[model samples]
Target: MVCVFSFFITSCEQNETIEAPQTTTKVAKKRLFKAAKAAVSKSKRTPSTSNNNHAAKRIASIDCFAYVFPITIKNGEEETVINSKEELADYYDAVEIGSEPEIVFPITIKLEDNSEETITNLEELDDVYDSCMGEETPCYTLNYPLSLVQEDFTTNTSNETVINSEIELHTFIDMAFDKDENAHITFKYPLELTLSDGSISTIENDDDFDAIDSYCYNYDDCEDYDEFDCFEVQFPIKANLNGEEITINSNDDLEEYISKLEDYTFPDFVFPIDIKYTDDTLVTLNSLEELEDAFDDCFYEEDDDTICFDITYPINLVKNEDTENTVTVNNDQEFDAYLDSLIEDDYLYIGYPLTVILQDGTKKTIADDDEFIALEESCDN
Candidate 1:
């Protein structure tokens, strides 16, 4: 109902003097208006692109998981057995437009984690899809010089604006619909964007943009085992990768091992591995279930504070300004734990000229207390 009303408003606006580009078809104009509405709604909720349509299509296709061999699929009255990824792709290619393929229930699927799940119905399949997608992470940064098509209700004119920075982009979006909600902004297509997978996509149309929207940028593409987050797995761990026994000695080794895995497969970790938390506390995970349980709460300390900088490790912390009782902190997790463990009367100070990593990943050395206070204020800005 809401979509119908939004589409009607866009149609009515186009009937006025608001001029679309000469090359844009009427259907294209409507799609652009819809994209504009989506952008406005998503920015209001969170600063990211909307991907509801794209996600639905991906969920239907089971992009992240593999169908177990010998599963049945029906296209109208025709039934067939799909044995491999190649056969499934062929089936999709040959499926008739009107006759959508339907899955034969009580089928099994292989997830990315090498776990097999029995999906009895569409609802169960949806649950598995949600689990496979995992959590939403930070989006990739939009490149500057991006364009937006702005609509002016008062003048009945549509003009394109080029945005050069993140700040300008936010300001323009905020002001675009200030006068009237119907007057919205849409993106000028044929734009180049960097996806979460580090691939460049030429978003030539609304459909192209929608397909890449709200995509979680994976720095390492390690869906379940993210190294940048809270806990660090004590290395020299054993795992079975593609029916081969291998020892992963470090994070690099783990990455190398994962790179060698076949599609829709993951390393089967040999149990009884140790992990160290942010608080510098070590714990042993005896099984995969325990490891998953550990990751359930393994968010980084910066998530709580929204800080813009990372402090360099191995900094000296003095308790109550006593140099004799100074403690050396190696990471953000340990520092956070130390701060939390402090009593009401206890005060802690860092031994300065401390080094810190800024938001842009540059290192800076703070020589005194005044400089540190200034740095904190800078983060607030």
Candidate 2:
């Protein structure tokens, strides 16, 4: 019996030892599986490394001219890409090793007397008056029977010969005058003068020559005189539409001018009318609202108390997206109301890319918001 009890106790001890190791092995395996699952979950929640590096990938730059989309510049090569102006500047600054010289346009001047002179540089125009001082017809005394041609279409135009000074010439060049258009000249400096009554004149520079030119150009009744109180020209006022030149003085003439543009289809955002001012200034009206506003400023009513000068002109309209969409508005209240309806219906907005030939003859493209506002302010002035 003693042997039996000892054997039973040994058996019990062996079983407990074997079971202890089994339990420990199962617990360790469970812990290892849980750790592995937790590691996998944490990895899944972490953001991708590729997403973090997205901004670093955008190293290329782009430039946009006249708000016409952008072209990318990568390693001195032009590429097509959409990029902000600031980004383009940054990329250019980083990669550019040297500066390139600016290219200048060659200019030629044509006088009314069929005398032609080519000016290869801006310096040549500086001493024109001094060079012609002792000649039979001095440059200083010559009227604007002058037309300028430049390799750049922006600066080619018929200008007033009154631009005698270097500063004036530079300013005129900067204005980017349109080709084949009449520009009114207003003097900014006083001229030593004698009136028709043989008395010394009190007329100074900075005076507008519009009234004087109006009488001289529109009427053939101007009297023969050596020099008048203001500047005047007897030349016909003309504008180049495409390649064809048209004479314009009245609303009918302007309508005939617009009739020539009926076959072309422009973008919906574009204002189709090309305006050539009396001063040879060029402006593209982008909206009917702007056209109406300009017209409002141009005309006046005649009453018994005042004589209102006629300033009416025909304005082209964009009615549809077709070539035949061209229509003319000539001081018609119904047409104005129709434009207002279009605006109210959200078919038209007050914004479009405006390319203005500034007073200094430089071409400025106003497409951004700030530029548009500045243009509006200038129009108000």
Candidate 3:
């Protein structure tokens, strides 16, 4: 019975046709959080060591151009910045650069870092600027307008003088004297003169200045005056002796004058027997006897037959205690031997007056060892 039912179903299925099911096509959906997960993973990764080293090298390097700013050159109120070649050229033209510049002004240098430094004067600024620009020497500005304080000392009739150097100072002095011939200069303030060798001479007071000025004014006149006349006038017949005119009349008067010769000490005796006239006339007598003879000749000029003793003794020896025993020595060798004997015996040590007549008919009394030695040396020579 079961076999017959299966055969009946099979026969019904074989008669029925099987057809495919039909539906709308659909695409697979993508994960929405995938991009966000990848981004978080990338953020958690460690930076490379090479990248860190590169950053440190960049921080260590210095930028010289950025830190260094253009220099600004200043003179008084005028100023200019030197940065580009054009700017430098413009500054040179404005300043009118030249070989030499006299007036120097203070300069101010500014940097890009907002820092500033001041150069004391134009010379110092020139040195720095020239060095920065690799110049061999300093650059000077020509004919820069400069106002200066000037102290003038010159005559109205003479040319105007400015005291700039020592030479100019001398010119100013000449001009000052030319203006007023009798004007006396007094330096109230101290003046310092520097020589070429760098020595400093200071005129501190009015007295020194006056002395120098007087010397300068009287130099020519003093040079023209005869200096030999001074000796003649100083030793006149009735010349001033300590502000008193002393009269030397006769032999007795001359002897008294010689006794009181206080002008010179021993070994350097100054005899009062000599008289110098204003005409450079020198009159000297050897002894009192000669002076008496000269006086007699002057008194009896008309009496030619008066038998005046006009004989001049070549050498006369005078002894102090034994004036009667004094002798005249005519022989040169004899006088030299006598001087040698005196020196050998040291006779000058004894207080005995010994005088000798010189070849020029002058009497000199040997008073000390120096005189004795001098006589001895002269005789030996």
Candidate 4:
């Protein structure tokens, strides 16, 4: 009986010893997995924060231009006024890590030439910012042997291509777009990327790739029309500069004449001015409206569905030549309501001498019905 009890106690002791290591191993694996997950979460990049920091850094280092004082900026729903460079710095330093601050539109910026330009939108602000930064686009060296799947739109078929170099990758993307603007390319994941810091990071999927792939657009090709391809005003042009007749023999002459003009006064060109296109085509512009039409022929020839300009309110609107029944539209809601009130065969006219803000942030004044009609026709094209 003594031997049996001793044997049973020894068996229990052996079982406990064997189970101890297994429990410890399971707990260790759980802890390791939790730690790994936490590390991944911490390392994932926040694109908004990254972009905001980049913008802030660039703005702080800007030397070519300065923001107009008492600029309004917003973070989420909260707005703040930045009165000086010191205040801007403080705001940048104290802004929440993930919060993005947007500059309010119509803020004026002082250029190096002492000319102040009112930036009407984020695109205008970006143009100024890019000019100050020397128009640098962020790009990174991508690892080779990356696989891309190209799909044929007509046939609904796909083929895999292994890109071995950056040039090859660029050529492939360009060729794809050249064939069809709607061409689709799917990147095979688990590819590695070499960051600016010379660190290698793996892209697991499209989301991961989108986070770091910043070279998504070309700065030079962003504009609808190439400035060089646009029509050039033939020299030795006659214009009434501040109501005084003057001849601008060259671009320099025009500049000199413009410099002498009083503030807010513009040259009224004597019609019919001649313009030459790059293709050796000559167009005779009968008036300022016709000159603008020639420009529209070059710029708005593309089939763009988006609205290219915005009218500044409160613009006066008159329906069917009823000058006494003029209505002032102050906002988009009012403008929409005015449109809804219009019926077929009802002629609507904007009260002359209104301002329009173009897509490129240029402000132009419409003098009369003819100029306004020309402007509307250009936008429609």
Candidate 5:
């Protein structure tokens, strides 16, 4: 509804103009005036995404997000972000968009402390109009820069003695924004660290910019997005922390950093509030685009059970946190029976199993029903 009205208004304003009332043409002029006003007024009104044409499309193929503990906010200052907010990802919680700005969402995050401040920055037609308003285009004036107000926060363990504990603060918001421009961003979690111990801490000082918006930028696109000064307002998540503003093209780098975080043992943790996963299933493969889809889509996390991913389905997994104790895909009764039933001469072996010792690379053995030979590793020593 908002996009349609915006398209009508911007189109009429540019092409047709409402002139002064002539003597004889009062009625015709009045109708035109009313239409022009209606268009403009409708354009100015808030867009109801519910009535959008692309709602079904969005539901069909959507982006997802998940937040996990010990999150590191890697973008901000030497400081890190900490979210005890152990959020289980529902399919809807992550973002979904279809067709373009029709179902677009430009997200801005409001911190726990700064709920009072009104979003004066990205809260207008022009804020969204300029980018979205292309002639003969959709003219989707998405309520530029959507905002996320902090609903509430709770600490796992109170800050009496400074002992650390996991904390997960829940935040949710319905937004409207341009389809492009960080519409679905994987925030490098901004987490705070305790100097004394390595335990996750939430003892935060909300003194800095109370609110953080991703689209908080001036109309003018700057050449050097290197420094914070390039933008009008500071974003919730900051890029170019240590690396020389060398922007990462994909979330692969983010996943690499997240995966190898334990190796580096980073000082601070920043939770950008945008974590996502590709699938909700257990047997999932990690891909470049899919890693960015990581929103920790774990169905649930229990205080007692530490098994991170889904454990309901029987899988080839290790027990007691030991990879050595693995559940290999061994030949069961059916498979063994099938193999035994095969004729001895009919069966073919690609390579010698016992002679050809196992190498470092991919080592899968194939055997024929020849002399019953037991295979042993040559490099056992």
Candidate 6:
């Protein structure tokens, strides 16, 4: 009886030892899970099922140009009460509205790429301007307050040209659009007498804007179009810009988008997506709980096991796995929203944030974060 009792105790001890590692693993997993949940709660990348999210994600917006004036108004008439830059900064501190006058230039963006673009416009930007005030499509209403409180008066779009006597400022404004000559924009800058005589600065309306190309869009050539047979006439826009030369693949569908906008009319097409489970081996998912009905509709990238790589910006924008969430555009403009991950359920739109174009016309991509505001802060008085 003693031997049997001793044997039973030893067996229980062995069983407890066997279970120890699993218990540790489970506790660690729980901690990790709690940590992940906490992290996601604070992150924008966290996907939610709230109805508010659906309403929020619906894309709606329109673009407009606004002019800023140094003068102030109580009802409508210009008041000379607040003309100083210091006061303007506080009054129109909201980046969406113009407390000061600016020469606002409006742009109509036509999404040439079939897949949804990754650029996202914020609600604060919406307060800048509105298209119309009705249930009709693209209705945000004109006279919507367009202001940028965080940015400086100089960087503000509506702010008239200011000549810096203390320092020479060379800036470039990057304009991204379909490579169409007809897609030209003309606006007279309300330059003060000082800037007109200062340095004879250059105004670049040309599209072959820069050589620091960071975009590569590949598509098969279309048989419908004439095969490399054109009469001797120089099509103003360059076929390609980056280090890589332009190569239109045979059976290409997008070639026509780059065609002359003056005559060519593009069809309104839609892209549909289907969702499926890619095993963890290929497209990795966080958490041990496998996603049931795992994915929302995805584009172009198939083979769920394979990482879905889709372009978000100009051309074939690539999305990699487990990297910093970024939107990279062509390094051709000082201010371009090409790389923004724009998610919306309303009309898409544009808002000019901080801008600093280089003399050489090299463009930089500023992430859609507070860092942009920090840059704007440095320029403010």
CA lDDT of each candidate?
A: 0.50, 0.30, 0.31, 0.50, 0.22, 0.23
Q: 3 or 6: which has the higher lDDT?
A: 3
Residue 337, model 4, lDDT: 52
TM-scores for all candidates: the values are 0.28, 0.17, 0.16, 0.24, 0.14, 0.19
Model 4 / residue 12 / CA error / Å: 89
Candidate 4 per-residue lDDT, tens place, 173-252, comes to 54343333334556666788777677788878655654563343221221122123455668888866544788889766
* lDDT rank order: 4, 1, 3, 2, 6, 5
Best-first order by TM-score: 1, 4, 6, 2, 3, 5
**Can you list the residue pairs that collide in candidate 4?**
none
Q: On TM-score, who's better, 4 or 6?
A: 4
**lDDT of model number 1:** 0.50
**Clash pairs of candidate 1?**
196-217, 278-333
**Candidate number with the higher lDDT (2 or 4):** 4
1 or 2, greater by lDDT = 1
lDDT for model 3 comes to 0.31
TM-score of 1: 0.28
For residues 242-323, write the lDDT of model 2, one tens digit per residue.
5565665654453344334322111012234555555666666656445434332332111111211121224334432233
The residue-by-residue lDDT of candidate 6 on 309-334, one tens digit each, is: 21122321222211243233433221
RMSD of each: 25.5, 41.0, 58.3, 31.7, 29.8, 27.4
> Of 2 and 6, which scores higher on TM-score?
6
TM-score of 2: 0.17
